[model samples]
Target: MKAFFRGLVRFLLKYYWLVILLTLASAGFSYPRMIHLFKTISTDPIDLLPQDYPSVQTLLKIRDKLKPKKSFGVVLESSDAEAIQRALYDLKARFERLPEVGRALVTKPGYAFFDKHKLLYLELEDLKEIRERVRRKIQQEKLGPLYISFDDEGDKELDFQDLEDKYRKRYGGDQTGSEFYVSPNGRIYAIYVESKKPNLNMAEERAFQDEIRKTAEGVDLKSYAPDMKLYFGGSTRVMEYRALVHDL
Candidate 1:
């Protein structure tokens, strides 16, 4: 064992320069290819996955076919709820017109849902007010051939409490009517920004993210609501967030 150890050390000492030379030569030969590969490689880790994998193949297929949408969530803070509401609606309208924006649910989905089923969601007083308004409108119009029908057979009627409970069970969130837009305290507001394209390449995805942030920043919340503060959240929000946080 001692003799073998001595021989091994001497052998290693004698050829150390040759080993170093071979390593340098190998690295020199492969360095350009490594650089090229690095340059061509995608930043997204998903691109690193084997294309032949079943999960990857399925994801690619679904992405190409269905184009699953992604969104960025935003939070706005202000003391004035009315101003926040006005700004929020204006912002939503602007987002709808943008080419890159698929949609902006600036107003809570629950509110819209509740509004569609207002008869079931609204308070008795509110319902009475609505009936009174309808009566007044009819009287004001003074139509000669007005036909009215209160059909109950077609309507699957349920008590307001039962309907409200069902709605709460189905779509329960702070984003529901009276609670939508402004938070319960009337300080915070939420907005959701969706991308126009589901299957986005790296550049397109970055551009979509940029558009959301840019749109938010361009709004000039001060102009819309002087006290309001806006910031973005959600998947792409970190990138878009740079502008909101920095500008403020």
Candidate 2:
């Protein structure tokens, strides 16, 4: 052990200067390129991933590294919930008209169980009052339709509850066709949104997504994803369509 130790130390000492000289030489030659590369990389402005979206980032990282995604937005106005739904119908027509959309289909495929924080099936006997009421709620509370659901195990649920409270406080009378109840036969609520269009532009596709999200207002969404009627599946086809066609 003593002999081995002495030899190792002597060997390192003997080669230390050569090692130092080589390192200096390499650094001198490579340092400029490395600096230039770093500077070029830093030319883009620093963008920090939003801290509040850890769970989303984690889930995505498991599939693919977190990539910066920007969503386009278009806000619409309506006097009340009925008007909003009506607007969605009109938008869908216009959306469908914007090019190759002859075969667009919209229907619930499979719904096992369903539930909502509150299901509203309102028939407005008097439209004026409801209009005024809706305007007040929207302007004062900044409210929109809220859909809440849950899957099995009942995990990640507080967001649904929060939206429920917000919806209740915001809307007023003359609303019917709404009830908040859980389906006794529920086991899974299909809890995912996809683009329905098999071929659509990205801008148009994303617009459809925003419109759907807006329309699902007052719809019940639970914590866990349940495979039930409450789970309205959004088509992912539209999302892929634009990207796919882009390559063509």
Candidate 3:
């Protein structure tokens, strides 16, 4: 039994190191390829959302890249009521003025993203009259779940739930359908709207310039630009989605 035990220990000691070395060698061989795969997976969203969207810099190039279908996103926000109203008017006017703008719509203000520097979030629900007006638009156009809407404020507006309740009672529950994000501070809110065209070469930077201008009409405004999640979800999710697409 002593001899057997000694042999067993010696065999285990000798084979254990060999097993470990093989495991490490295997991992080393796969690690570089795994890292390369990870990097490629991570960079796919940058493909879906070209880096130069807000500017018309890549418009002509992108128009060529997309032969028949071209889509673009517009995100805007305002702290000033007059600016917001002006923004609405400007957007409506621009939609009418631009012959190329086939799909014209606004997002729900409540479904927006704001910066983390904001101090207060006002309750911004439609007034009874305003709700009636929106209702009229919906009924008239038969726009059911078709429209995506947002407000000047995102979820943080609910921080003042009582005030929001008052606004809800005064206005109505369905503010807008568009969904968006609000920063931790009350300084910024973001809402996304989209446009489609057959060929928008050098996309009209002026397309929604009026709307953006309207949002800041006669008010002190700060700009932080915008970010969007159209192809999928977050950065991690995009990697997973790309892997799935690649696998298929």
Candidate 4:
């Protein structure tokens, strides 16, 4: 063991300079490659998806046709549906004005769908005038299962209770609720937002999220509906959505 240690000490004394020179030369040779590797690295999870996967293929195709859209889901809380709806309308307008936002949908399919489907999501008195208009149209067009003709108005009952019950049974339990913009219980409102293209850079992605949150927070919910509370969700707000999509 002493002889081996003496030999090792003699070898190191002879080769220590050579070893140091080799290591410095190796580092110099690899410095550019190290820099390039870091330059190409991505923090975005979407970059990790396999190129052959169906979602990746679909995403690439979408990218070719249109810029990828980031979705933001807004949850608004208030007991006053009318005031909440009005506030949401104004909030949506404000969101649209932001350069980052592409589109904002406070109510699904707008007033046309609401006019015809009020009994599905809203209380009977929420849209009394529109309901009356829809009722008149139903009478004129003889819509629904019974298809009661205008002539049979006095003779046959035009009750929509069965239809309402069926709609509630079919859709009330779904996550978005039986209604388009409002929840079944009527205390929560949903907004679906589409944002402009996302930047692959981490700093830009952070900026995107901050812009979305700031825009939501800037809305004066108190002026329109004092009880309203705004909350943000969906892909842009939650990065985990990217992982979930990749798993799918």
Q: Pick the lDDT winner.
A: 1
Task: Report, for every candidate in turn, its global Cα lDDT versus the true structure.
Answer: 0.70, 0.40, 0.44, 0.68
Error of 2 at 228 (Å): 34
Answer with 3 or 4, whichever has the higher TM-score: 4
Two-way lDDT contest, 2 vs 3, winner? 3
Cα RMSD, each candidate: 11.1, 22.2, 19.2, 10.3
Lowest summed-lDDT stretch of 10 residues in model 1?
151-160
Candidate 2 — number of clashing residue pairs? 41
Candidate 2 per-residue lDDT over residues 169-194, each given as its tens digit? 56532121132111122222121233
Candidate 2 lands at a TM-score of 0.21
Residue ranges of candidate 4 with Cα displaced over 4 Å = 1-46, 49-59, 62-67, 110-157, 171-180, 198-205, 241-248
Please give, for residues 96-182, the per-residue lDDT of candidate 4 as tens digits: 888878788876655667657656676556457457756776665665556555554544444665555555576544433433577
C-alpha TM-scores of all predictions: 0.54, 0.21, 0.25, 0.53
Write model 3 residue lDDT over 123-226, tens digit each, in one string: 23434444554465555456545644464432121234554456446644433211323333322334333334553222132333334334334323232222
Local distance difference test, candidate 3: 0.44
**Cα lDDT of model 1 by residue, 134-180, tens digit:** 66556545653363435442222223454455555666544454645
Candidate order, TM-score descending = 1, 4, 3, 2
Off by over 4 Å in 3: 1-10, 42-173, 176-248
